[model samples]
Target: MSETSPAQRRPSGELEASVLAALWAADGPLSPAEVQSALGGRLARTTVTTILTRLHDKGAASRSRAGRGFAYSPIQDSAGLTARRMRSELDKQDDRNTALARFVSQLTSEDEQLLRTLLDAADDTPQRPGTGPQAAP
Candidate 1:
């Protein structure tokens, strides 16, 4: 992975995913200045602007002219974005089920038992009420 820049680093040095997260969680569009104010960080206004423009270019945000500034809204809300990202990651895995199985197998005994219990519970759970099985006619 490429080194994260100061402008893109979170309080914990992770990439600035939370900034995009915040904008996506907001109820309406926001200018870069508004984003900066909402972030309440040491980041320069330009840094926030750069991040927002990058998001727009990546198709993550929609931008519209608002007088001299551009108002940006998240193209996908936070939940949608998270689902998209999760699906994308799963797609990139060669064998997602196998990976999960290996991870579960490698867990401590207690954790492994917990995983088995959870899987058993899931297997015992019934399908949705209106879907799948129905009573015999």
Candidate 2:
């Protein structure tokens, strides 16, 4: 049996990112077919649909019934997506404080200073309505 070449396959995360980018570029929500076309038709419609479905399950995207199929829209920008991933990873740890301390230790001096400033600002700011965690739908 012949093995599939890496070039012939996309990393799942990369495909998700591409789909998210297409959604972000679109002025309105896009169907899987539209997403596939926006991605230069490199991916199959089913593949695009599956990626969009996964993103929706992860709360990274939202979908609503449009005609016969669904139209998907990204709930978060790229930076928000990255932050979600980071938070997810941190949540997996039994010792979140230790994990965060290690992560902070790995950051550059500038990043550390920025983190300090952000933390200070966060301490002063009041939690705005609908800005923190929301109840699951």
Candidate 3:
């Protein structure tokens, strides 16, 4: 059997990301066939369906019946998804404060300042009871 070429092989998670991107760009949920077409000819409809199923299983995407096939949509926008992933990684650490400090330390000065500004703004904003990261506990 011939091996797949490097160009044909995708980096791990790239396909799922592509599928999610397509869903995010679309105005509404997309069927597997629609996702495959939106991704061009690189992925098969079955593969798209599998990716959508995996995403749904992980709660990254939501699905509903669209004719005989299912339509899928991203549960969160791209930035929201990335933030959730970051929070998840941070939550997994034994020493979360140290993990966060290290992460903050590595940020560019501009990003650091932006973070500070965002934090300050958050402090001023009226927060609803037991909402947001600060209220997790």
Task: Tell me, by lDDT, which candidate is best.
Answer: 2
Candidate 3 runs further than 4 Å off = 1-8, 131-137
User: How would the candidate models be sorted by TM-score, starting from the highest?
Assistant: 3, 2, 1
TM-score of each: 0.53, 0.85, 0.87
Q: Which stretches of candidate 2 lie over 4 Å from their true place?
A: 1-8, 127-137
C-alpha local distance difference test of each model: 0.76, 0.91, 0.89
Model 3 Cα lDDT, one tens digit per residue, 33-104 = 889899885776778889999999988999999898889989999999999899989989999989999999
Candidate achieving the largest TM-score: 3
Clashes found in each candidate (C-alpha, N, C closer than 3 A): 0, 0, 0
Supply candidate 2's per-residue lDDT for 19.
Answer: 93
Question: Candidate 3, after superposition: displacement of residue 133 in Å?
Answer: 10
What order do you get sorting by lDDT, best first? 2, 3, 1
Question: Model 2 residue 104 lDDT?
Answer: 98
Deviation from truth (RMSD, Å), model 1? 7.1
